[model samples]
Target: MSTTPSTTPEVRDDSRPARIGIQLQPQHAQYPAIRAAAARVEEMGADIAFNWDHFYPLYGEPEGLHFECWTMLAAWAEATSRIEIGALVSCNSYRNPELLADMARTVDHISAHDAGTGRLVLGIGSGWFEKDYDEYGYEFGTAGGRLDKLRDDLPRIESRLGALNPAPTRKIPVLIGGGGEKKTLRLVAKHADIWHTFGDVETFTRKSAVLDERCAEIGRDPGEIERSVGVETVQDAETMFAAGARLFTIGVGGPDYDTAVLADLLAWRDDKNA
Candidate 1:
């Protein structure tokens, strides 16, 4: 891992083109609908297709239709040929670290098919959502304890990825989603290839500055990590882009799973990238 200090904006590759990711909320819908949305996002020119990791609906009828994350990702791996696929952020507590690594490797290979590289992004985070832990029979420990587990398991994941009989087709990109300045950002500095968060430009800037400080302490270039933000529409992405976000993710909930907002964002991405 190259950790040479990136002291200024020029040290980082600001010329990298902006990209769009569409997160199809896997709630209130059936698998067929979710699968179609995955294909639709790709046809609409989304750079990546994401589904969240959760056991239940995040809103609007907590007990409504829902699906597991990794299994659906496996389906997406075979369903779409061009789109990158993964959970927006997999909870580190849900599965054993090594087992998760094997699962990811399998999906990576599946997505690669005949292409030389895989499109799987291993977006992971320390567990939140107390209901998931309680319902799934895992301990809903303190936030700090969960962070400790994530810190401990990241290396284990990497080791397992290395030790697999046939290694992952590509070095699977690891996207760590959180903005916790103390522990989460520090872990992002040490382990993440992409960092996803939610906030206005000011909050994004402040937390990103903290991330830069974390990277500096570890002698890692901040540019090694891609800055990601979840936005509601194209208008919301402008400020974040100006604030130096390169990856913009739009989340659409299910039942209808409308892609209007995602289309608008993709138009903006095309212009920006051009």
Candidate 2:
């Protein structure tokens, strides 16, 4: 993972316009509330709606109400019309990669009811969350090991997507989340159609440079992958946008998934794109 600068041309195009995403963290709230919030965000003009992949709550009461990611996404596929639906990053270890591919394809079809193209973004990453691993009986291996698994399984998932009986309605976009410069960025360079991570502008710029280096090493144009940042405010989004990020997302915890600010951000998105 040496950062020795490459002489390759800078083809990492970050010229894409900004789009807003909301992570309605499936925690603290009941199913009805989560469902309603998903529908509401679609109504509010979000470009993407994401939930997280975890067995338990990430914050607030650890045992508070929470829901699974994929099943909820299936419901979202039926519940919403326009906004794209997915986990922010599905844990690669939770389900078999082939099975996960099938699930994604099915959800893709479900979401493509109106238009013939699925709105499912297959956002995935190596598993984290010790509780999710322990409670679900998954082997919580070392971080490196889990990443290795993700790297290996991604191709299988892709192959399975190709082999599915009826075939996915469209080529489902693969969004990989994480910023591990050594391994994650390289995997992202190889497989991701969208790359997501959380950091300030400086961190994003630095890691994005490393991502550029990774893509150059493999002869892939980094611009092919969208840049997604998990942001909390307009200022954060603005700074990252200035630094070449196109997708900005906010996380809203449940009980009450307040998203009034999302309207403001959506306005910002429109302004940027305009």
lDDT per residue (tens digit) for residues 1-274 in model 2: 6665443323345568789999999999999999999999999999999999999998989988989999999999999889999999899999999999999999999999875789999999998899999987999989999999999999999999999999999989999999999999999999999999997677788888898889999999988989899998898988888777889999999889999889989999998899
TM-score of each: 0.95, 0.95
Clashes of 2: 0
Runs of candidate 1 exceeding 4 Å displacement:
1-13
Clash count, predicted structure 1:
1
Error of 1 at 111 (Å): 0.5
Local distance difference test, each candidate: 0.89, 0.91
